[model samples]
Every structure is written in structure tokens, then in C-alpha cells.
Target: MVEIKRPSPTDLLTIGEVVARTGVAASALHFYERKGLIHPERTAGGTRLYPRHVERRIAIIQVAKRLGIPLSEVAEQFGTLPSDRMPSLRDWNRLNERWRARLRARQLELERLQEEMTQCIGCGCVSLNACLVMNPGDQLGAEGHGARRLLPIEDEVPEGVGRDSH
Candidate 1:
């Protein structure tokens, strides 16, 4: 079980509070609110007041976006919870479960990326001078979308395997 650091104990959280609770920058919280994923109320003096749930939601949104989940997908998940109102423990638990699953996938991806990069960092370093990357026809980003392949390829298909069964 993960424990969120309660940076603010009061009902109202300041911009800095949001930053600490969400591990997001204060500017990002403002941007997300402007994007309508988070709605913070105003005080009599016009200070922004966010329910504690917004902190958790912002954390979830940050992770989801880092994984390249679209804003619509994050919105759909936010719709499952009561935004204007504080969430019950059950609601928080449900959010935690979803987050843990996403984190697990992200963890696996990072492990594989580490392996790929470690392979690329070999002492021989001859691959750097190889013509393998000199071909104008070859492109790595063209092979896949999203950040999953931001690292180098660890494997490529065998030659002659593209022949159709006859």
C-alpha cells in the first residue's frame, strides 16, 4: 500500500500544497485546471481551494499522460469519481488500484528500456560507426508510435521470415 504525503492537513490546499500532493509543479496544476480536468473553487478573497481528491486525481493524470494516455481517457476515469466533493476511502482505493496497474506497466517498460540502453552502451562501440544507421531509408520512429520505443531496438525480425505461406 502506498501512502500519500499529506502536505496539507486543512480542508483547503494552497498551490504549493497541490504541487507537493500531486508531485506536479504549481504551474501544471494551473494548466490542468485551465484544461478543466481539475476545478478549484475560489475563496472570498479569490484564493483557489481544491478538495483533497484533486491532489490524487492530478497525480493520476500526470502518470497517465506520462504513459501517453489521451486527455479523454483521463477525463473518463475522473468522471468515475466525485470531483467537487471529497472522495470516500473506497473511492480512493479504487483510484489506487487503477494507478498501481498503470504503474506496474510503466515499471516493466522502464526495465526493458534499461536493458536496451545497457546493450547499446557496450565497450566495442563499433555500432556507432556502422552503416546500419547510415541508410536514409531506415527510420526507428517510423517503426512505432508513442514513447515506448524512445530507446533503441533490442531485437529485429529474422531475414526471409516475411515470405508468405504458399
Candidate 2:
């Protein structure tokens, strides 16, 4: 009879075990280590061993990637977490709040883009020079050239500018 060994909660996991459990590629794990996103201990033979909490960290990293957040930003956020121990629920909640704001802003920008595209399609006049609704008397050119409306708005819209002006 073959006996299957079950890992205890306190036991450090091998790289193979982590890959199997997290469904992340071994290459990706190595890349994360290289990027300073995760820190694992090395055995006398140089085998990597990850703490149980690393699974949670990898999950956070994967979610950030899916949301289009840069790895640099992930590293910035991770910097706030405690390195000596697993992150607490409160720590995770703080990160969630920050990411939620960014995601909300992105969602609003996408919605704005969708509305502008719908207006452009409805007019059937793709000519920017003749489009009075989008550009009138080349006013946007005064703000510096190249798709002025497509640029991300950082502050209050200027008077006689933007979709609201149309």
C-alpha cells in the first residue's frame, strides 16, 4: 500500500507544489522572484521553498495583471506589506481600496470612449476636419496637436472644450 503525504499548514512548499496549487507557470514564479515580488527560502541543495502565504500573494499578483495594473505598481503596493510575516486581512483590504479607485477611473474612461465612438459612428462623417461636433475651428489645435480629446483628462475640462461643449 502506498501512503500519500499531506503537507501541514506550517510546512514550506516546494516549487512544484506551489505551481500545482497556484496554477501559475514555474517560469512565471521565477520571474516573480526576480522581480522581487515574492521571496522564498533556499535549502542546502539550493531548492526553493515557499511559505504557505505565498499562494495569496501570487493570487493578488495574477488579479493585478488581469486588471492591466503594471507590475511596478504591484511592487509598490507590496512594499507596504509586512515582509516578516503573512499579510493580515486589514492589509489586503487597504490594497483593495486603492486598486478599486484605479479600476473605477478606468471604467469611467472606457465608458466615455464608448459614447464618443457611438456619436462618431452615428454621424457617418469620419472626417475630423469637417466634424463640427468633435472639432470646431481647430480649437483643439491650440491645446497642442494630436487627438486632444483622446488624451486622458487630468483636471476640469476647459471651457468650450470636450463633449459637453458640443
Candidate 3:
């Protein structure tokens, strides 16, 4: 009879095993290691061995990436934890809160940009009469480049319409 040996709970996973389990490319894992985002032990034979807890960390990283969070920001959060231990539930909660706030801020910024686009579809066109009131002779051009004053709101509006009327 052929014998099949299964990995025990304490057994470290090889890079290939982690790749199979996490669906993260081997190159990405290596890049994460190089960037100090993840720390994997090496066997005497110079093979990478990851602890089972790494799967959770990888999941967190994937979630952050999906949320449009940069790897550097994710790394900064991970760096707060002890190098020898995986993040506890409390740690994950704190990180989640921080990321949630960042995402909310980004959402607001995107909403503001969308509102500006609706206000001035052709910012470069001179035929827009409203541009004189909204942009005031391309005053945004002085604030460097690419969509300035888009975040700020003016008090004055047409008739009884408020800023959010449109």
C-alpha cells in the first residue's frame, strides 16, 4: 500500500504550497518578502518556509489591495505588529478601522471630483458662460495643474439652489 503523508498543523508550508493555498503568485510572495511586508523562514537548503498564520496575513494584504490601498500603507500597518507574531483579532480590527477611514476619505474625494466634472464638463472650453462664475478666468490654473478648487465649495449659488442642489 502507498503511504500519503499530510502536513501537520505545525509543519511550515513551502512556497509552492502557499502559492497553491493563497492563489498569490510566487513572484509576488518574493516581492513582499523583499519589501519587508512578509517574513518567511528559510530551511538549511535555502527553501522558503511560511507559517500557517501567513495565510491570514496574505488575506489581509489582498483585502487592502482590493480596497485601493497601497502596498506601502499595508506594510506600514503590518510593521506595527511584532515580527515574531501574527496579528491578533484586535490588531486586525484597528487596522480595519484605519483603512476604513482612508477609504471613506477617498470616497469623498471621488464624489467631489465627480461633482466638479458635472459642473464643468468642458473646463478647457471658452464658450461656457457658467465657467466665469465657477472657475473665474481659470483661477485654478494658478494652483499648479489638474483640477484645483474642485474640493472647495462656494457659498453663493443661483437663486434658491444650494451647493448640493445639482
Candidate 4:
């Protein structure tokens, strides 16, 4: 009869071990599983076993969360990785580059918001009828409804208005 060798416990981490090592709650790990972000192997007794490398994945997810990157975007980026193995250093670099671009865009948007926020909120009308002074006869209404000025403009801003006008 041939004898089979089982992998050492160190090769696979149980859910509790993963929570301890990653400093993530077990419920969060389960949430990640449900979101299809991480895949773990199951034991005969219905135990979950994660590869040691899952800690890296959890770290990446946490960073993305901290950056306000939506889980859907994280999942999309993770989709680019090979499912069979841990992400390589090159893979991590690629993810970093992608996230950096998103962060830059977010920073610019936040700056724009900060510059405009004072005026937007000052009137208390919040782009309603009282905003006619800034908007002027509902000219912005021609473009669209719902705080058109607040929306990001794709082309040159309309003349005779905006942050510089006031």
C-alpha cells in the first residue's frame, strides 16, 4: 500500500489563524469570501483553510478600502491576477499603479469640491431657486437639472459664471 503525505499545518491557515495574522475580523473575511475577493479551500468537516499568501490579498483589500476604492473596483483589479497562485511582486506593482491613478483623480476632485463648496453651501438653497444669482435665470438648467454647476464639466465652463465670476 502506498502512503500519502499531508501538507503541514503551516502551509494552510485556518480562519482563526488568518484573522489573528491579518488583524481582520472573521466576519470581514467571510464578507470578502461572499464578495468573491478571496477563495479558500474547505476541509472535509466544513472548515475553511486559506493559503498563507491570503494575508497579502487582505492587506491589499484593506489599503483599497482605506483609500475609498469601491470593493467592485478592487474586485475588478484582482480579477486581472492569476487565480492559481499568489500575486507576484510585478502584479502588486501593476495594482499600485492603477490605484495611484485613481487616487490622483480623487484628489483633484476633492480639491475642486473644496474650492467650490463654500459658495455652493453658502446660499443654503443648494442650487435651488435661491441660486439664481450664481446661476442667473436658470441658465444652468439648459444644460441639465440637479446642481449642474456642481457636476464636473467636460468642456470649457460656460462664460460669465463659475468660481472666477463670483
Candidate 5:
């Protein structure tokens, strides 16, 4: 895998540069700004000016989105990030740790789902007798009668359900 290098402190990045570095679209970055997850300043010419830290934040935001985390949750997970300054090491570390845990949980939940799917495929739905899909841990289907559920989960779970652990 290729290593991602952080830009030097002296290097200020444009929104385009940040986009290129993070592999996130400019529109997505704008969406993050609207959600208060990331922000870039307006230049005198009205272009967006971003710091190197913003690139890092964009990367984090993208991964969180891929894990099905809504922008609302991401904002809650990370307190307001200031647009006028560089993010501190402590802030980055705390955010990184939190997101990593969320991603890990998401991976585990997905693994659980995949295993149940494999069981279903192999045992001809007989394992649905014990699987989370057919028989969740609790009276999950009691709330409503439907083909599917409003909430995908059959039981109450903490945030970031499916995560991959190394």
C-alpha cells in the first residue's frame, strides 16, 4: 500500500489540493462544511482556502461516510472544528481513536451479518431458527408487522455496529 504523506506546515492547500489529497469530491467537502464536519475559508477572490489539516479531516469524513455514519453522528463524534486554525494533535488523536473504534464496530457487525448470510446460504434458511435475521435476540419484530424493519437492526446496539478489526 502507498503511504499518505502529510504536507509540510508551510504548505497551505486550496480546496482542489485538499480534494486531490483526500480522494474526496469537492462537493462532498462542501457537504461536510455544511454539516460542520470540515470547513475551508473563503479567499478574497471567494475561492475556498484550506489548510493541510482539512485534507486529513476530509479523509476521515469519507471513511466515516463509507461506514454508513451520518454527518449528524460524525458531528456529534467530533466537536466543532475551527476553520480559522490548524487542528491540534490532541484533537486529531481523539478523533482518530473514536472513528477507528466506530469503524471497527461496523466491521464486526458486518461480519456478523455475513456469517449469518453464509449460514442461510449453506443451511437453506434452517439456521434462521437461530440467526439474527429471522430470530433477533429480542422481540424485534413485535414492534411492527412488515417485510422489513424501520431500523435494520433487530436489537438495540451501540453506534458503529459493523467494524473490521485487524
Candidate 6:
């Protein structure tokens, strides 16, 4: 039988190697490529060859995803970097700083929703007092549609329900 050759750890890694190393699906890597999140080089025969640093990038992408950052957003952030190199610690710090505010805001919004959900649990239907106070002639519907009251606006947070609400 002919000997099967494998890429050395110091050499460029193929997509399959990246999948094995990173535990990210091959399809996701392709999607990352398409979205411009990752930039892999092509061999003369057209096989994708990723620098070893891609493993770290893939890990970063996974962490960002778990933090509820969208792939588009990840792509946008990663787009600021040089394609062939690993992101530096400073780069990671900058990325985190940029995402910190957005993540905090999202956390606040979710907390607000949770509070609203808890408060509104008792009244399941149109009641005399709750209806007048909550729906208020369906004014929320005018804003668009779909449980508008459930998602309260920043200014609309009830007397005791926002930052001060909690």
C-alpha cells in the first residue's frame, strides 16, 4: 500500500485538519469563508490551506457566537484584521471592548423582558383594570405588531421596572 502523507503541524493545515483541530464543522468554515470571517489560502490544486493560527480564530468565533454575537457581526469585526495572521492580544482586547457595550445592553433588555414576563403572568386575558393600564386601546399595535406591549420601550418601562425598575 502507498504511504498516506499528513501535513506537518508547522505546515499549513487543510480544511479537514482545521475541522479536526477546532471541532468546528467543515461547513461552518465554508460559511465563515463565504461571510469573509476567515481567509484561507488555496493550493495550486485549489485545496484550502489555512494557517495554524486559524485554530485560534475559530475558537474566538465560537466564543463570540456563544455570547450571542451574530455571524455577520463577527465577520465585520474580523474583517478589520490582516487575513493571514493571528489576532494579537491587543486585537482581542479591542474586539471585546467593542462588544462589551452591546452585550451589556442585550443583557439589560433580556432582564427587562424577564421582569415583564414575571409581572404579566397573573393576568392572562382582558381584565377591567389591567386592560386599561396595559393595552390602553391597543396603542402598542400602532407601533407595528406582535406582542408590542410585551417588549416595552426604554421610556415605557413601568414605574418600577427598569434599571430603577429592578
Best by lDDT: 2
Which prediction has the highest TM-score against the true structure? 2
* Model 3 CA deviation exceeding 4 Å by range: 1-11, 121-166
Clashes of each: 0, 0, 0, 0, 12, 3
Off by over 4 Å in 1: 1-10, 88-166
Q: Can you tell me which runs of candidate 4 are displaced by over 4 Å?
A: 1-10, 118-166
What lDDT score goes with residue 45 in model 6? 98
Q: How many steric overlaps does candidate 1 have?
A: 0
Worst 10 residues of 1 by lDDT: 128-137
Q: Write the per-residue lDDT of candidate 2 for residues 1-166, one digit (tens) a residue.
A: 9999885544688999999999999999999999989988899999999987888899999999999999999999999997647898999999999999999999998897777777878979867765655765786676765677675774657876776655
Ranking by lDDT: 2, 4, 3, 6, 5, 1
Model 1, span 46-78: residue lDDT tens: 888887767767767877877777877677777
Candidates in order have lDDT scores of 0.70, 0.86, 0.79, 0.82, 0.72, 0.78
Would you list the clashing residue pairs of candidate 6?
160-165, 161-165, 162-165
User: What is every candidate's alpha-carbon RMSD to the true fold?
Assistant: 14.3, 12.0, 13.5, 12.7, 15.8, 13.8
TM-score quality measure for candidate 5:
0.58
Tens-place lDDT per residue, model 3, 1-166, is 9999875534588999999999999999999898788789999999999877788888988998899888998889988866566667888889889988999999998898777666676565444334544565675576665665455446445577777767
- Taking all chains together, the TM-score of candidate 2 against the true structure is 0.74
Clashing pairs in 2: none
Q: What is the total number of backbone clashes in candidate 2?
A: 0
- Candidate 4: residue 130 Cα off by (Å): 9.3
Candidate 3 weakest ten by summed lDDT: 125-134
lDDT of 2: 0.86
Query: What is the per-residue lDDT of model 6 for residues 1-166, given as tens digits with 9 covering 90 to 100?
Result: 9999874434688898899988999999999888888778898899999888777778888998899888888888888766767677898889889899898999998897776566676556454334434554665566664664455576666675556534
Query: By the lDDT metric, which is better: model 4 or model 5?
Result: 4
